[model samples]
Target: MGIFPGFGGWINQNIQQPLKTSKRSKNGKSSSVSEEDRYIQGPWYWDPDISPKEKAESMEIDHVKSMPLSATDPRYYDLDELVRQNRLWNSEKKHPWNGAPAKVKVKTKKGLCHLNIDFTLGSPPQSVSEMFTNPRNLMYFHSMGKYKYNWRTRLDTRATKVLKKDGPRQITEVEKVLRWKILGYNGTIPIHLIIDENHQKVTATYKKVKVKHMKVFEGSWKIQPLYVDQERLCKSRSRISEEQYKKCSGGKGRIGSKVTMEHIFEPSSLLNVPPVSWFIRGIAVKVTKALLQDLREYVITYNKTETVDPLVYAKIKESIQKEKETELKELED
Candidate 1:
């Protein structure tokens, strides 16, 4: 035999045989692979055409995509009827005056509360990222005076690091002190937040900053592009004629940013007075919804009045196009 077998048979046995092996035993039983092992074998060993760097990047993308968007995400929360039946909860009991988005959900467990909020801004991802990263814009949106939070006053604000580059991510951390008048209690609260930005996503996490009225106050904010599903695009195109689809730029969906915010905190005052939990939750819900709405409005207004630099806008647009293309390719494959 030539090298143990003919060329075609040897190739099949040596190259493709392992892939065809059932992930089961001869007893017709299924064998589960550990996540670590699967991760190693799935992308690293399977795709020989991809370079190591490309494989790493693809894994990173998959990881980012698989991250939990919120506590309410099905990946983390069970939607079974029994699970829902045992729960004691109320959602959207009090709507904010500015109107809350449908994606907002508030959940309370024991004495702790969580808010899962999702919204979309009118501007592209780059513009939204710029607005969030800029201190001036942040102050304008968050300062008590700007938002007219009569019950709260900003005492001082500081940033340890405005911006630092780590590999492909930009990191920033800020601290603020605010005086609050809640339930006839006057106290100072400190807030600390760290923001990390890569090319495709921005994540903001609140550190364990001490606050007089809060035992625990921490959360995360994530912003990424909202990708239209390929199947949806195909259906839309099928509905329209080819000429019409071409005129509409092949029915390419409008590019927008998807923002997800998760807030988990327990106010000392609220815990001290269990009856007022509902009141506190209402305030938190209102404030969170109002802030999201304000940000959305602000981005729309900013885009209308200000235009990003030609070169910067070009780069942002190109990055967005690349993301869209990648999403489409993944769907196709």
Candidate 2:
């Protein structure tokens, strides 16, 4: 009847932890704590430095220009491979996951782009529209374009009931309608949907729809482990009375180990989805220690240099030679 309520309660789902930035004490001592020992609560939203608009723009530009993530970096090739892998994961039909499309509108400092898609009318209620129109969603796509969408119902509920009786499949048909959003150059677009039964269509043109690439950091999720904190709880007392010594004998020597809590989850997983939500539901859970170890192997393979796998080194050398040849030929011309 209303928008879905916020999730509540503690979810003890096991997930992997992303790399965290933490500062050491002035003495420059390494934390004796293992990351796994930390516990954190969730509904963890992935926070990238740039706004979603910026991400969309970057992706659009990269795609439209057929450019790699980093043009100036040699590792761009490898990074491109990674990006391909990321997109492949999203587009796979077996996975009900969709990587956010980077929508961009390129103009001559003053142009527009239009997009058109049909909607099924009466399939969504007013509450769904309200959710789509939420401020957060609006701002997320504001730079891409303004939405001018409408839905026309093809059949009433009563008529649909009659149609279901006659059809062997007994499936009710939703109204077909077209939905569209329009945006100026460098505008953000909101991704909202409406239903229309009478399939109508609309068209939109933009100066550029290809923006920039989404910056996906190397993400890992794992179960947080218990940790012992060693910070001193209070100043050391001199000449403890026998009674006092007995009272705190077991708790001696600069903050004994204490339990730590941390939160970890899949990088691409949605924050709003409930814990234990299946990976097929677009929330990645169930990452295990073994998966992390395997991923580590891949990362290590990518990192090694002077002594790389012979085949890999040979391929790299061949690529280098070809690149050099191409450069020389261009220079001669």
Candidate 3:
């Protein structure tokens, strides 16, 4: 399905308004119409000529709540419950130093610190990896208006190369360099991120990306299998066949994936102050949550549309099947 069904009609109704061109009067003066007003469509003046009962019904229909029509729509989310759960999870899983979801461990000898955060995503590792590695998708996640205030953000992929690969379960390494910049930023932040895919895990790592705000910035995103109980799996479904549940349960339970993001960075002197650290941490949490939420929504939207790449989807399906087979083998052993 299209991201928004009936989007053409929506554009006609809400965006593509017909404009009335401005005209100068014979008296060498423009009419009362302002420049901005001339570009705006005039207010609706057509008489509906409908019955009072019909008008009341129309009003009622306009006020009636409807299911989400698109991934970007606000009605698609349970905002209060999601926020509450995310906050509670972050609070309960905080590191000792700061009350953030990421653990901070200082390496006194090396004069550096590591920030580690782990969470579970709803999708499989292949889909997550594909989304994260794509330059366009990365921009969508990072340049979210609510989370990022900067404008004119751009992401350019400099190069991509496959280094080496073994079997499906063996290590497959790929490297990519990206140039990123935002409006008002002095210079571009060039990132060299490496992606490692294996049977058991997929990881993306970047070491030291120099930016104006930080002396050091490095991070890794890793995904690995996670198992959940049958009861939990059943909560996601209304009904399940006994045999089907047993097969999917794989003796232990249904399989999911745990995603971890780790970063180590030293801020520039301007933002290295004590108070600024707290503010930065707050922003980091908000942005991270927003990124995850957007990723989930984007994946759902992509799956519904016909624009998905067949080759990539095939690889993802194969990887998932392999994972299931591996899990079954492990159970047998």
Tell me the tens digit of each residue's lDDT in model 1 across 3-116: 111222323333322322223345657576432222112100111123456444544433321311111111111222112111111111121112134378888887788888
lDDT of each: 0.44, 0.22, 0.40
Q: Which runs of model 3 end up more than 4 angstroms from their true locations?
A: 1-114, 135-156, 163-188, 194-200, 209-212, 226-229, 232-256, 268-286, 303-307, 312-333
Candidate 2, 1-333: lDDT as tens digits: 010111111111212223232323456553533332121111111111224564455434312112111101111123222222223222333322211212222111111111111112110121112112121111111111123132211111110011111111111111111122223222221111121111011111111111111111111111111111112222344544323432453432111111111212222233323442332112111112222222223222222324332222333454567789999999999
Compute the lDDT for candidate 2.
0.22
Ranking by TM-score: 1, 3, 2
TM-score for each predicted model, relative to the true structure: 0.47, 0.15, 0.42
lDDT by residue for model 3 (229-329), tens: 34654444545553465466553233334778876766666776668765544444444454565554544344334433322232334456778999999
What ranking emerges by lDDT with the best candidate at the front?
1, 3, 2
- Name the top TM-score candidate: 1
Query: What is candidate 3's CA lDDT for residue 239?
Result: 50
